[model samples]
Target: MTAAQFRTVQQPLDPTAAVGEIALFDAGGNPLDLSGGGQKITSVKATALAAGTAPTATLANGVLTIGIPAGAKGAPGTAGVGVKSISLTKDTDGNITGGTVTKTDNSTTAITVTTA
Candidate 1:
């Protein structure tokens, strides 16, 4: 020990501001079961979900309304097994412009629509 008393001691270049306590591990290293009741692990600030200016659906007589596409409204068949015979030949006409839907075991499914 003689290179002029071997002087070399300098370590504190912003060492994470000298962290006080943060030892929590569990991926087989055990010791991280936070007690199951007083949950504590907090530090989260990065948010962006508040840009508002575009939501118009007004109708006060100027009439701007759109919504009338229907299907899946078949319930109440128990008095004598009623809907066992209700076929729309397919065009339930919610508007694709063509129709065919016959299924109660007679099996006949073909409803095509292709438009670009």
Candidate 2:
């Protein structure tokens, strides 16, 4: 849901009923100068996302792209389910030595790789 908010600036009226054109009163029974009929509003929100499959996005240059990458398309056929989770063992280093990936059938796949 997108919405806009504006801060309301209002002044209280006087205690006595001696007014003519809805006199503007402040908190201390003072008149207010609302000559400027323009109110300062927050920011207006953008619209919702377009209709389509989910996509990857990137935020840069004061713009948010919530769709497929530029000039990039989906590959043919469906992707096979594999590697739901991976647990890698590191030797005092942040290099990816090897990891285990879980499949959709609750089975784990041992993955061994050398990083140099």
Candidate 3:
């Protein structure tokens, strides 16, 4: 049976309260019989597989084991620099020629601008 066939059970007002019983139903709203030789999940295990591998699941000895592939690690990122202030360089006609970007750590970088 698929997980979609079972309905979710809502908890009582007190989450710590003991549950008397759980009812299982199908997608068609039909109740399932839990009478003869009903099996209970005894254990669950998860394994990490190599990157690019597909996820898999298997049931054995009332235990469920799943294998999940790990995603590839991305390249290292460049350090971020915060801007603190900027100083503009002006030409003879008071037109902006370029500027200097001052970082939070007191470091400065020059920037060029093309006036339109």
Candidate 4:
């Protein structure tokens, strides 16, 4: 091909409008197809790595896999102090008379509810 045969060109591609399709090429400069018979992602897999390990990703034979380090279970969660359960005292008519909020550390707080 002569230099005169090659000229710079620019065109807007509207992917959503099905205006154009991307061209694919192989390592040897051979053109590839993007149809069902062409190379495509066939599988995906993820694995959790060690706590101190770094995250990584890889693609091979149409398979894409990712490896992410499992976060350190977060210091055993610091023994949550949030409410564990709420025991309510109800009347015969199913009215809430009073209640107690029990926390995760076995601490309790009495709750007085007024109904109209």
Over the stretch 44-103, how does candidate 1's per-residue lDDT look in tens digits?
A: 122232234222221223232222233445678754322234333334655464446655
**Which scores higher on TM-score, 3 or 4?**
3
Q: Find the 10 residues in a row with the least total lDDT in model 3.
A: 1-10
Give me the runs in candidate 1 sitting further than 4 Å from their true place: 1-94, 97-99, 103-105
Model 4, position 78, has a per-residue lDDT of: 55
Candidate 1 clashing pairs?
89-100, 90-99, 90-100, 90-101, 91-99, 91-100
TM-score of 1: 0.14
List model 4 lDDT by residue over 1-116, tens digit each.
Answer: 00011111357877779563333344454554436674465765777889987555554677645666787775555555898999999999998899999998899999999867
Q: In model 2, where do residues sit more than 4 Å from their true spots? A: 1-80
Q: For model 2, where is the 10-residue window of minimal lDDT?
A: 1-10
Clashes of 2: 0
| Superposition error at 28 for model 3 (Å) | 24
Which candidate ranks first by TM-score, i.e. highest? 3
Error at 31, model 3, angstroms:
18
User: In candidate 3, what are the lDDT values of residues 12-104, reduced to their tens digit?
Assistant: 555577543435454566765545665455765778989998565554565556677899989999888899999999999998999999998
Residue 34, model 3, lDDT: 40
Question: How well is each residue in 21-116 modelled by candidate 2, as lDDT tens digits?
Answer: 333333454544435652322322233444464333322333333343234455799767865677887767666777788888678888899645
TM values, all candidates: 0.14, 0.27, 0.38, 0.36
lDDT of each: 0.36, 0.47, 0.67, 0.62
